[model samples]
Target: MSWDDPRPMSPHLQVYKLPITAKLSILHRGTGGALFLGLILMIAVLVSAASGPESWASMHSFLSGFFGQLIIFGFTFALYYHACNGVRHLFWDIGKGLDLENARKSGIAVLIASVVLTLLTWLIAAIV
Candidate 1:
């Protein structure tokens, strides 16, 4: 086609809808990045504990606060999601759950498992 000629353009993201498996795949990548950040927070807690009582107390205080708890909750969810999705990927690697029906079911299972595991973790932590 000539440069001056009008060319057809692909659909924009706003005009296109992604399937559940595609959305879950994107979320899996995002949660991986969030887990990296969570590791940094974990290190900070460790360092604070090793430093002294004052440092430990400060870290504990922040961790006990609402915003800090919210971050921890999100981190917990990300951790479970990454793990669950990794297992799904392993199944795909083995040529299981690669079909449309199974793939969608696996995607939904990952989401449900992540939320349930996250809540269960928090519940157990509160109990102990």
Candidate 2:
């Protein structure tokens, strides 16, 4: 359809602000990608461990660094976010929490649960 045509155009992202559910859906995809990359990094770590003592030490050294630790934290957050969001999708598949308010509440709960679970795992790991 030509822009000059009198026909009404379908609403696009540029035409309207996305709602919370849309935002969360976007985030869910992003976290899934992050988790995939994180898995690749994990494989690298394992391979380095199997390579040699020096290789394993180098990998460990990088992991112990500030930047590496930051990446690890991000990976952790992504892991938790993806898992919690997956559970949310499970409920959706069951035809529950399909309402706007329920979806919004569940999205918030997913975010909260992801953060809480990530922090709890890290804290418990550190304590042990």
- Return the top candidate by TM-score: 1
Tens-digit lDDT string for candidate 2 (1-128): 67799988779889889999999999999998998899999999999999999999999999999999888988999989988889999999999999999999999999999899889988998899
lDDT of 2: 0.93
Q: Scored by Cα lDDT, where does model 1 land?
A: 0.95
**Residues 1-37, candidate 1, lDDT per residue (tens digit)?**
5768788767888998999988998999999999999
| Clash count, one per candidate | 0, 0
- Residue 54 in model 2: shift from native, Å? 0.7
True lDDT of residue 6, candidate 1: 82
RMSD of each: 1.9, 1.8
Top-lDDT structure, candidate number = 1
Q: Which regions of candidate 1 are displaced past 4 Å?
A: 1-7
lDDT of each: 0.95, 0.93
